[model samples]
Target chain A: MNDRNRIPIIITIMVILLIMVIGFTSQQRERLTPVEKWIGDFFMPFQRIVSQGYYGVEDQIRTLIRSSEIKQENEMLKEELHHYQSELIEAKLNREELMELKNLQQTLNSIDRSGFSEPITANVIANNSGNWFQMFTVDAGERKGVGVNSVVIGSGGLIGRVYETGNTWAKVISIIDNSSSVSFRVLRDGDLQGIVSGSVDNELSGYLFDPDAEIIVGDQLITSGIGLYPRGILIGGITDISTSADQLLQNIEVEPAVNFNRMNKVMIINPKIYEE
Target chain B: MRRLFLGSLFFFSMIIESTFLSYLPFPSLVPNTTMILVICFALYYEEKNGAIIGFTAGLIKDMIVGRVVGISALTFMLIGFLVGYYNRKVFVENATTPFVLTAASTILHESIAFVAVFLMGYPIHVTMALNRIYLYQTIYNALVAVPIYFIMNQILHSHFLKKSY
Candidate 1:
């Protein structure tokens, strides 16, 4: 570890570092080829293991929080017996809402009669660091009929689609993903078909190419039943519209009804099977 | 055997990071924890083996969630080498250097990722992206880095540096 030896080692390391940076930059500039895709698939298992461990930790925290809340409630009820009836009614309403959500899920499942008939339910595993697009991993995977391109829906509406799948886990690309694009139509006036695209920050928006297409800020957007996704699933609501003086199409912004960050339960829609 | 175990642990942690930890709702400007933790680890263990581990971890990460290929691997490798080289000379055995380095490295890692995306013909709004990167996420990553470093260091030490004690 003499100064002369250290200097040469540092210079060699710096040269190696320089070469690596150049190689990486060149690779990033290119499109993701089949080789890259294969590599991505190979690494998916590692992602799942990490996701599962964090989920386990979070699950314990959630259980502790719930149990503590329940204990507090039990103690409070001893002194405030009169309010018990109202609390009971509130609890019943909460139960009913939960049941309604379950029913909605079942209905969604029934409609999605793909070859892979089993339903996959996943918990919200994570969020992005500082970007608008929030992603999640579900416990369901190939073993449970989860696959890439499967649709995911939350309580609010169509959340996103499965982008990566492992044996026991899957990663969802939320609709807010900047690269995501879906063919959607206005529920009120089905005439307006436009491509909904995600912004850099997952602020959902799109461009309607048809100049005469009838659309407004309050209109609802639903999957157009074109391409990978099935028809009539709710996407989001139009939040704003901006028309440039010379532009042919109307620039639009949408606020996704589905709060992907808070979603605890999601149903993965198996890819549809077409009859010959 | 220890190297294998440590390698698997780091690999598993990256996966959890992309899948689940990425979904947590932080206040608008929090940086990603995984990027910071990985950077810190790369800096703390800058040996040839450490660089290899860092590169493997980055490669695994790139495959899982990143759009670009090789970027994370290259970045992690560089950070690992620098950190390792620095550690050998300056002796950052304490926690403060990790905290400061984690903060700086998180920013560097994100910038590189963002620049890579932008350079790939993607029409990115640079200002907005930078806002997310520097303001919220940098702060968040710095805060989370200490705990993650502590946990990861303990795991690495127990698994790989058993003879040191």
Candidate 2:
């Protein structure tokens, strides 16, 4: 290309870049536009194929890593199995009795039952190519009854909440993001309530309602049914606790139960009208 | 017709980057394929075409990512233009140009993205972005450019191969 042609091209490229920058900057950052949604829906099939491919590769890697450990675990499990065989009958009878007692308790505190409902399983399709485990896309969307604000959980516990929905896909904001906060309470002491918030380092820290609350290390935390997340979902275990002399709240730190690095499949809670 | 093919290639690369790339053990280690392609095309073709391809690819990426729409587009266009323009000045048909150009473009592209993302009101850690995105991706993308350059060169030169008489 000659100088004359090059000049025009450079000018055109700069003009387009400027326009796009201005246009995009002015748009809302929180919501996807119609065109963006259509583009995402268009790529849904490709997303599924890639998602499967990703999981297949991850499974192979996990298998390779666990190959040696599996042998030891197998030996351990077999020994434990023989021991449990003798106790299985007694445990079954105890479970039956416990079930009867639980039924009586449920009848009494039926209204205060933990806020948990069945979930809709979804495949994790894609993630933002960044070190921060903040955002990811799931294969279920409005078409499959997935809506924004639906709680998402993996095998371990609370992962995040669905923040954006397209026709065939929904974007999940993981609990590890800087913008995420969840209302939680101590599993051992239900009255000890607090709000756990995510930081840039993918750790959770928060403050308890009472500065005088005696929080101990290893205290398991669960959702308090205060926000979009349902009640009784395991958030994590408290790792550290501290309190300043003049502060009104105790500083608490929690290590999340779900490992964001290994997350592949998640279950999204469908819209259910819980009795308030 | 060739431009159309190149456009399709960029589009497919974006799809793979967004979907398949996420599954890699450390996804941040995966080279930015589209950015490498942009640099390769700019060096092989001309700066003008490179800028256009980069812009289109960036637009598609932004749309699929559902983030700020212009950040990638602007970053890609500028990187494409600078790489292409300097590629013409250097006019070196040697083996080192693609690697060097790819590295420079990757750093430029990622820096532009970091600035644009920050401007869009998203909190960014400067040192982390520089190390993870700029440095890591530049090295990875430069390495990726080697094979991609050879493959694209072969495809572009296929018509030039005469019959074995």
Residue pair clashes in candidate 2 = none
What range of 10 consecutive residues in model 1 chain A has the weakest lDDT sum?
A25-34
Candidate 1 lDDT score at position A56: 77
- Residues B1-165, candidate 1: write the lDDT tens digits: 666665666655665566555545553344454455555566555555446655667666665555344667767765666666676777766677767776677777777767666665555777887777766676667777777778777776674577643
**Candidate 2, which segments miss by more than 4 Å at Cα?**
A1-31, A57-68, A71-118, A131-133, A205-212, A240-253, A270-276, B1-4, B27-29, B160-165
Q: What is the clash count for each candidate, in the order shown?
A: 18, 0
Candidate 2 per-residue lDDT over residues B50-163, each given as its tens digit: 777777777777666644566667777777777788877877776787888788777776666556555555555677766767777677778888888888778666664322
Predictions: Cα RMSD each? 9.2, 5.4
In candidate 2, how many Å is residue B61 off? 1.0
Assess each model's interface with DockQ, reporting 2 decimals per model.
0.31, 0.43
What TM-score does structure 2 among the candidates reach?
Answer: 0.78
Looking at model 2, residue B148 earns an lDDT score of 85
What lDDT score belongs to each candidate, Candidate 1 first?
0.67, 0.76
**Which residue ranges in model 1 land beyond 4 Å of their true spot?**
A1-120, A123-134, A145-147, A212-214, A272-276, B1-12, B15-20, B27-44, B64-69, B90-96, B147-165
Residues A101-193 of candidate 1 have per-residue lDDT tens digits of 767877987553233344567765444333533455566766777766888888888888877665655667778777678899889988788
What DockQ does candidate 2 score? 0.43
